[model samples]
Target: MSWEKSVRRVTPYVPGEQPKDKNIIKLNTNECPYPPAPKVRELISGLRYEDMRLYPDPEASSLIKALSGYYNVPEDQIFVGVGSDDVLSMAYLTFFNSDNPILFPDITYSFYDVWAELYKVPYKKIPLRDDFTIDFTEYYGDKQPNGGIIIANPNAPVGIYEPVSKIEDVVAHNPDSVCIIDEAYIDFGGESALPLIKKYDNVLIVQTFSKSRAMAGMRIGYAFGSKKLIKYMQDAKFSFNSYTMNRPSLELGIAAIEDDVYFKETCNKIIATRERVKKELSALGFTFPDSKANFIFAKHDKLTGEELFLALKNAGIYVRHWNADRIYDYLRITIGTDEEMDKLISFLQKYL
Candidate 1:
């Protein structure tokens, strides 16, 4: 009991439900319905089991080189982690140490607040406009005076993509703090704020192989920042754990990056599916923000979000729904294969 009193405690983030049944259509967690690049399959079978006995490259140099060549950023500016969550947690720990509160959208990624609370970082959640879009002017640190900022472009659940110009404005205004842009879904259809990294020394742009590369299982996430910013993050990470990236992840992540053609094709397919499904959902009396990501956040004109979520679940379909304020009426449905989306539409048609 004495030790328990000193233990750090905070409510953890609740992820989308991962049901056990394999036969059901799964569109809950915003994962790519498609398989990873064909090369990834080839690489997995060829990997030496003996390699696992040795520790992976602590710097993850090979993977970093691959990413550097692909993204055209210098290797020194790059940092890799187990996942974007890991990368973000490290950034929060390394940068948001100020007594003043960090800032993020109230309706943005749920993990931001959890990380803030877990690390004892004071934070302010600025409310998104009624249309579920961020008011960039509100993010002007000159007015709000915060220690740091993190934003999820093509914001999750809502799936609205703010323009790079708007993102740039936030970064420009907040020169005193580290501004992080979480672009996990940027490959889907959104323009990235990555260019701003060159313009602002204080900016860190984070991305993941999980969503677009179909390697969420591999848990590869990386960031690009000024060399100084990245080095500081590396010092913090190495101090915490040098071997955050394992052998399989490093090798497979490079394989995923090298298959440029396959990667683009997969993203295009998801985008096409998303646009078609948008039209279909609209016809079905559902309305949602224009989604640039691989998911649609929808609410039916006649039915509640939970009603549809339960009905679909009972029919062996899974889509995400939240009981929280403002978005309680919405369902965040990951864009699956065309057949899966058709099945979803067919079920909704019959049920309605």
Candidate 2:
């Protein structure tokens, strides 16, 4: 009982279900249906087993170099972690130390609240508008002198994207606090807030390889910020774990970012599929927000989200569904390949 009292207790974030069967149609988690860049595959196959014995670079210089070359940012202004989740968690620990509650959307990424609670940091959930768009005025910090701001550009689950100009308005208003724009799905269609990083020292723009680069398995995510802001994150990361990134991830990440053409082609394919699926879903009497990410958040007119979710699951299809209030009737479906999308469309036609 004494040890139990001292143990940390908080509800952890539940990720989308990962089914083992290869036969199932998985559109639940927003993973790229295609394989990683060809160069990444070559690097993986060619990596030597003997190199595993040695510790990886604490600085992750090689991956940072590749990112710098790709994004045209200086090495001192970039920070890499195992994934965006790791990067965000470290940032929450590093920057959100003030007593005022941090601000985020009520229906944004579920991880934001989880991290806030885990760190015992105060936070306030500013509700999104009726149509699921962020009201930038609420985040101005004029009425509420808050600690920090972490916004998922094109906020997740809802799949609606806000413009970078609006994001800049928030950043400019909250000059005293750090402003983090979690751009995990930005590669799909949304404009990035990266340019703001150059103009505002408080802005930190985070992106990941999981969605567009098709390397979710490799777990490479990075952030761009001013030199001083990046140094704070790096210091916090090294203090926590000097070797957060391993050798294979570092080498493979370099290969992923190098092939620019393949990455763009892959994103284009997904965007095309998503648009087509949107029309088909509309014809079947489903309404959803205008999604800019690789997924659609949809609700059917005739059936509850649970009913459709269970039906699809029984038929070996998987899409994300949540029982939370406001979004309880919606489904978040990731865009798969043309063939895979066809299978999903066919299933809906017969089921409806």
lDDT (Cα atoms) of all candidates against the true structure? 0.94, 0.93
Clash counts for all predictions: 0, 0
Candidate 1 ranges beyond 4 A from true positions: none
- Candidate 2 residues lying further than 4 Å off, grouped into runs, are none
Cα error, residue 268 of model 2, in Å, equals: 0.2
Lowest summed lDDT over 10 consecutive residues: which window, candidate 1? Answer: 189-198
TM-score to true structure, per model: 0.99, 0.99
Which predicted model would earn the best lDDT? Answer: 1
